[model samples]
Target chain A: MDVIQIVVIGLIATVLIVVVKTQRPELALLLSVAAGIILFLLVLGKIGSIIDIVRDLADRAGIGSIYLGTILKIIGIAYIAEFGAQICRDAGEGAVATKIEFASKILIMVLAVPIVVAVLDALLKLVP
Target chain B: MEAIRSLVQNLIVIIILAMLLEMFLPAGEMRKYVKMVMGLLIIVAVVQAVGELVRWDYRDEIPPLTEKNNEAELSGIMAAASRITGNQEQKALEQYKSGLSKQVRALVHLHKETPVLEVDVKVQSGRNEPDYGQLKEIILFVAGETSSGKESEGAVKEGVEPVTVQIGSTIETDEHIENRDSPAGAAEADLISMVANFYNLSTEQVKIIYR
Candidate 1:
């Protein structure tokens, strides 16, 4: 979305949250969560294009695609987990947000497993 | 240029996004975290765009800055030059003033053929004095002249008191002839030259008063 539209929507959501929060805290929290998710989805398309561009450039440079893919996935996990954690925290579910962060850390390491194995395999072959 | 243009565009978008988050986010710990994360992401995006530019060898597409480099160096050199000149001017003024006093005492002692008893020098309404170049000219004028006779040596043998004068003020009667006020002529010209030269000034620039 364009900047102006995002700003308008954010302002409207902020006012709505403020008005409902005292009377209905849960509803206010849900509305904020919805707004956050919508903003993330709006930027996701642009991010996808940027990723494609990076991938193409990396391919042209003759770099292995696996490492690049792993890094991109890690970054994607970081962003999504952070997003979810923010939504959870805003909902006053701080414990839930903490657990989400812990899960994302494990998920990122899992995604890096192939790169780690590949490096180890290469190092083993280099041994005289 | 395209890389830079897109970087600026993305940064603008990130800034708008930040403003939105800051406004809509609840005022608490989570809001702080979101702002921090958003700021970092914006920084990452800017760096990524710059990295793209570097990879494309975009720097070569731009012209060199030899002239601008020289300009900056010249400006730095000029600043140092001005500082040196300022210190030089202060030293010149001080040296000139000191030399002027010494020359006046020496000339007076030579003129009277006796050492001065006592002298007092004062600066009255004085500053922005002549510089070393003018002092050089004055010292040259006096250097070429003789103390004018063998009598000065004889008088020195007589145990005359030393001569003195306030470089810019009055001296005791015995030390100076107060002879500077003598009219412009052969005898007075020497003293007039003394006064003029002491000031590193011209005869016209020197004002003589007899007391």
Candidate 2:
């Protein structure tokens, strides 16, 4: 998006948030959520470029597509977790945010298990 | 037909999304969430409709400024200028040349350097006529004065007959042209400058028509 378009959207979001805060607190939270999602959509093209670079790097390093995909999945999990956590915090739910972060870390570990196992196997084979 | 189909599809998708969100939300909050989603959907629909209307209108309204058209509009302004200044054809020509320079300067002040494609002037002869030219002149004077760091004192000369000018933009059909509407304040000012020069009046006296 051009800077003007982004600024316009931001201004509209700010206005909606302000209006909602005064008249309806719950609606304000919803407006903020919508704004965040819209902003995310605007930057999605850049995110895709980042993912493409990471995929190319993994391929050149001979890490295999499966390994790269796992890493990407972990990254996606982290991002979604953080996003949800922030939304919860904005809604005044600190406990929900902490739980979200905890769950994300555990999920990341779970996704990394296969890569860790493969590395261990390679090392054992070299010893033999 | 295809656009209508796509629009129907979008509406359906929005309705489904709203319903899903309503299901997830608490019973008390569902109504508010649903209403907000509906409002957003309505905004999207209105924006889409307006965009389509503009696209259709622009397709018909935007026309290329041919050399013949350009000459005709220029000569018309020249005729009007000559009549107002009580100058002969040759004197009008001299006035046009000097005015062209002023016009170029005004454009440059607006940070524009493109060749002018065409110029058209419309004058209100009767007192009952709306002073569109005056309004246009004021807009241009304000824009030029602000951008060029020049005072309005000499921008428009007095005793010059007031005439309205409509500057039709050059139509770009080439892929590289990247055509867009004139900048925030420059177009109005440029038109005024052109009319002022054509009629031997100051920029302040020349009016621009914008709509």
Candidate 3:
């Protein structure tokens, strides 16, 4: 679905949640969380499709499939770390969340080292 | 999976019923354990339900075949890339075939000939400048040329390289000659106009970089 459809559905869901909250606050919270999750799943599907296309293109470009995999894995790590950190903050464990974010960055940097080394190798070979 | 789902659903019902029963029963030490069990059962039930759903969805689907060689897939990928990078795929392919002989002798390391690169045009209006719809037309004109597959490949290998073209007047002030905007009592108004103009981007399309 397009951005407009997603926004309209979100707004409708938010309105339903607000109305439900007035009667059953607990159920309303649950429904709100479910709506957010459903939306997240939809967006995640789009991102996965995009990543697949990028991977295919990178492979065709002779950029190496492994390099694309590394980039995607790095992206996944960053996203998961951010996701965990956000959940921690929502649970009032901001310190733990911050630690998770820090760890994710360090891990990403480590993961990127191989690509960096390969790029350097490519450049050096180009130098004569 | 079906059995697991049924078990989990039953467990949820049991937990809810237990919580309700505890509300009526006497407030004793057992109440705490009952509530704890209720929470554990609920978590277990939800996890099992989700797992069952995933299993059921994938049960009939064939697993993707693993392939080490991706040369054919790579060609399809290049075609998609041509479309994405605004090159005519057919044109690029034709150019690739025609130029293969020339490229083979020139470069021994690179197997495939690189397509002609495209230039990107970025036009920015002044903060107080009026919006011009013509900019969009210009961008489309520059971007739209990738109709043939041959031309597309040619563009990718040896097309006009992409370049950003910026068009706007720089603001000048006594304090700073290279100021982005005119500074005066109109700071807020100027800033708002600048922001609005910035959002009104036109012709951010890719163009071929002709040699």
Candidate 4:
């Protein structure tokens, strides 16, 4: 698969979605969602090595992986929330999408508390 | 990094294909639910990918089930089973062959004249059936078991190494007693009598067919 191939794919999908939307709006949404999911899965396999690289970098920095783990979780929450929000918006559920975004932000905030506390504690120690 | 790049490329291709396929699917009333499910699936996948990116295999922390599968354990069990069954099968085969050898000892005189070869017994058994009580059926095939062509001593030394044979089981009958004057007929008569006497059954009760 190359740029041209992806462009071809995008062209095909765009045409199909356009044709489907006019005949069946629901099917168009389903098509778009399915495409999004498939794209996500394809990118998933790529992420494993990226994770390895990040872990390697953290190890080099003499940082505990616990904080890095938390950060990863927060990142996941944010990404998922945005994804859900987008899907909801596409499905014409603005309120539901907004709620999803709100929930994701809260979850991410909660997840970051430990890191934030540690950072603050370190700053206070430096001041003292 | 190159692998990841290729993966992303493939993913784009897959997305396009999925779009084409989903476009053709029936737009059911649960469109919102369908979208939610798809989005959730992607999100979970992404989370898993991201978790794996940091090599955070949290699954190792989870407790195993009582009967979780272990490859080494399973292989050992399988090997032990195969060894046991192999021994049992060999034993059963020898027992059957010896039984046939004894029953046809009188027919040794007949083997010299007739096309009668030694009986080969193969027992088909299920996995758990060690004693072979669940043995479905026994196949009896006879091939070049005659030791007449080779040196008699050499034949004894060669031994029976379980070669493939496809012939069916054959039984001698007394119905042709009227033709007992001929050598083949006489051999048949003797065979029927010997087998019937051994099994304590009338010759009429036994059924034998050749393939």
Which candidate gets the maximum DockQ versus the true structure? 1
Model 3 RMSD to the real structure? 36.8
The sequence of per-residue lDDT tens digits that candidate 3 reaches over residues A9-100 is 78988898789877987776666667767777878767766666555544333345565565556556665666667656655678998898
lDDT of 2: 0.53
Q: lDDT values of the candidates?
A: 0.55, 0.53, 0.46, 0.51
DockQ of 1: 0.03
What are the C-alpha RMSDs, in order, of all predicted structures?
22.1, 33.6, 36.8, 22.8
* Model 1: residue A124 alpha-carbon error in angstroms: 4.5
| Candidate 4 chain B worst ten-residue window by lDDT | B148-157
What candidate 3 gets wrong by more than 4 Å, as runs, is A1-5, A12-33, B1-211
Fraction of real interface contacts that model 3 preserves: 0.00
- Candidate 4 accuracy as TM-score: 0.37
Candidate 1, residues B165-185, lDDT tens digits: the string is 456676553323333332322
lDDT of 2 by residue, B1-211 (tens): 5545545655554444434333432232123423343344334433444345445545466653465788899999999987876546445544655565465455545535323333333333233457522222222322222333222222332233434343586443221222134342354445556556655667655533211
Give the DockQ-based CAPRI class for model 2.
incorrect
lDDT of 2 by residue, A1-128 (tens): 46677789889998989988988889999998898788879878876776676555434333357765665565566667777887798889999998987887677667766765665555443331
Q: Which sequence of candidate numbers ranks them by lDDT, best first?
A: 1, 2, 4, 3
